[model samples]
Target: MSLPFNVQRAQDRMGIEDPMADDPGLFHLSRTERLMAFGACFVIGLALSIIGSALVFTGHLAVFAVCYSLGNVVSLLGMCFLVGFKKHLKMAMAPVRLTAFIVYIAFLALTFVSAFAFDIAALCIVFAICQYCALAWYSASYIPYGRKIIKSTCGTFAKSI
Candidate 1:
């Protein structure tokens, strides 16, 4: 099946090739199937995250941390369905994304440590916020000029302040 015009255009602009264009060896899936898998994983991850957030009211910090972290990880893994796992890892470890990736992973781990080991709710919250910011930064790195735009906007806001 043909891709939508916008999606095809964006893929062209980004120099992205269809994962199924070449034989992927094992676990092959058509574009539509891959999209379905990605969508399913993303929705499941979002549900887990929402459930974790709701658990916060019950004061189950450890469970919240575990669920939230797992949710984020699962969501991230969903990208592998669109791009192969090796390609995803290569892009993640690229120089542009390295810092954001490190910070994101660090915060993810720190959130768990603070919640389960240290039993520090405040610290866990702080780490969770950092993890989210890092994840956003990492995601924005994928778009053309996205990081530059964000930096410039933040700089302008800082100057105004």
Candidate 2:
């Protein structure tokens, strides 16, 4: 009979045993942890954007612009549901704001493109600048809210919905 190719392949040339064979399980993120992870993703987005801007008159763009844009949209929705709509005011909201901050940094590339293409009129540019100004202003606004949310999450109080 033919040997099981799959089983036979397991015997590597090095003869190393399956290192993961004894692992009980893998790590899984909690709901809150997932949010944090998603929020942290924005930071990665910003870094990619900077690197992209340096290459090919804007390289690494696929990861930064498109991916970051997607992240922004997802973060916005999460904020709406977990913070804004809940209006529970908690420190947890801070992560979402952090996401926004990351999104804004990523937007610089888009702004550059728009500037070159003149996508928006002077008013558009002005408005875009103003938008970031307001976003920055409000990023700090959520600190107190975030504190409350954290308290709620930690079961200190029913702060966030």
Candidate 3:
């Protein structure tokens, strides 16, 4: 099956030679199969996150933190289906994305440390919010002019305020 124009273009830009390329002695899947895996991982991650949020009111902060952090990690791993894991890491650490990636990763780890190690619910929540914001910034880096648009909008709002 042929890839959509946008997907094809993205693959070209990412330097992917073949969507069907397989790791030796490992699972071999077509683009459609990879997409299905990605979808499944995404849904599972979303469900975990929702479940974690619900658990917050149940007084299980630790569980909530574990579930929420795992959800984020799983969702991130889903991208490996589109680009190989190494390629994904390489792109994530590219100069344009490096700072956002570092901040996002730091917050992700801090969220867990605050919940489990420090046992501070408030700190965990704060770190989680920071993690979310970092993830958003990292994601925005992917779209053309997305960060610029966000900055301009925020600046306009600030000026209005």
Candidate 4:
């Protein structure tokens, strides 16, 4: 069976345009939108770290904590690189961010379930779901704005950094 929702419907419901309407690779966003996206990601990272710390302090779920840390490291590095190329990455940013979001959420869910009390874990899962979706959407929207810059730099900017 097909899903009940599609990207277009979601955008329409949220009062946003088809972020790729003009040049499939150019999504323009406001400053507030960009800040909100980054903030949401930061919150998710903080929450995961807190949960990881809890697991470490209790001397339990060591395996889960290890996995969480590994995933966080990969995601953080990707984000850092993406941010450095944000003015140039263009169409590719959408898929890169989407992949990071999915992998991080999966690791987050597994970590939360294995590390915390049922009640607290459920709350964290719910909050993470909402925040991640917002982060993914905004990240996707902002990515297109970097197309021109990335194309010109050809990654030399990232190399220098």
Candidate 5:
């Protein structure tokens, strides 16, 4: 007895609700907010890649290779986290941030090797200062939590666990 168009209209009306009905949380950034956050990350990555490429163009092959490799490793880790965690920022921070920091330090130290091997001390120093600053900012923003756990007791011993 009901027209198909009327039934469709009823279904559509039933689906409407307040977009902000849910409380906002770390994982609940609106689409525009998410886009802006992602854009900032992308711009930083692009700038770092460009600096690495500039090293290549200026004949610092060893430095360029080290920078390039570090970038690739970090990017790959991020991609893996995004895929496995479905973009859950907190999940990515818990383990991957520490892993990425360790990897970054290892590769950053390798840049010193390139500096010594190629005798590009000044250039490497400048690059290191910039890279460290950028990384500190990145870490602060993305991994706000530090390694902290409540105290725990095991059979006969107690410690901060």
Candidate 6:
């Protein structure tokens, strides 16, 4: 079997000699640039974590402080992991994000149910706040990095960010 003409024509027009050709663009990320971006992300995570922890000691701030603190801690750890295990962390990001979204929705359901059934309004509210903080931390950590990495790795699809 052979590839159809449209595919061949498209390839020819794009000047792609081989389907598996390595675009020089993919290799454009200098080691120094990677290091700088990663270091900035780590600093941001640490700063956010410190703020969250401070809030936790601020006279019973419902569950928001606790949630924020916990989320910030985990996010900082995740950032560290990403810096050290770049390939593995990148591979896991998509699945981890998807799973978090689904779980976030499920937690919303549970929060409502618990509020109604157990009258734990404060607790429920805190849980939701915690979830939001975690989401924010995770998003802050990866979304920027994801964009940069994807841009660098997009081969011919690469365009200005």
Q: Which candidate number maximizes lDDT?
A: 1
Indicate which candidate wins on TM-score: 1
- lDDT for every model? 0.84, 0.44, 0.81, 0.48, 0.51, 0.50
The parts of candidate 1 lying over 4 Å away from their true place are: 1-26, 152-161
Instruction: Show the colliding residue pairs in model 4.
Output: 88-149, 88-150
Error of 1 at 36 (Å): 0.8
TM-score against native, each model: 0.82, 0.31, 0.79, 0.29, 0.33, 0.32
lDDT of 1 by residue, 11-128 (tens): 8999987654544423677778778888998998888888988887789999999888888888888887777677778889999899899999999999999998999888888898
What are the runs in model 4 whose C-alpha is more than 4 Å off? 1-27, 62-161
Tell me the deviation in Å of residue 29 in model 2: 8.2
Q: What is the lDDT of residue 149 in candidate 4?
A: 55
Candidate 3 C-alpha lDDT tens digits along 51-137: 987887787889989888788778877777766676778789999999999999999999989988998888988998888788878
Specify the poorest-scoring 10-residue window by lDDT in model 3: 19-28
Please give the range of 10 consecutive residues that has the lowest summed lDDT in model 5.
147-156
**Model 5 CA deviation exceeding 4 Å by range:** 1-31, 60-101, 116-161
Off by over 4 Å in 3: 4-26, 156-161
RMSD to native for every prediction?
A: 3.1, 16.8, 3.9, 14.6, 13.8, 16.5
User: Residue 1, candidate 3: how far off, in angstroms?
Assistant: 4.3
Summarize candidate 5's per-residue lDDT along 1-161 as a digit string, tens digits: 12268755875788743222333434566545544555555555556666776887687766565665466435434332222334434433566465645545654665566566765755665655555544553354343342221112232255433
- Per-residue alpha-carbon lDDT of candidate 6 for residues 56-129, written as tens digits (9 for 90 to 100): 45543444343444444454444333334444345336665656544554564555555456556566666656
The ten-residue window of minimal lDDT in model 2 covers 18-27
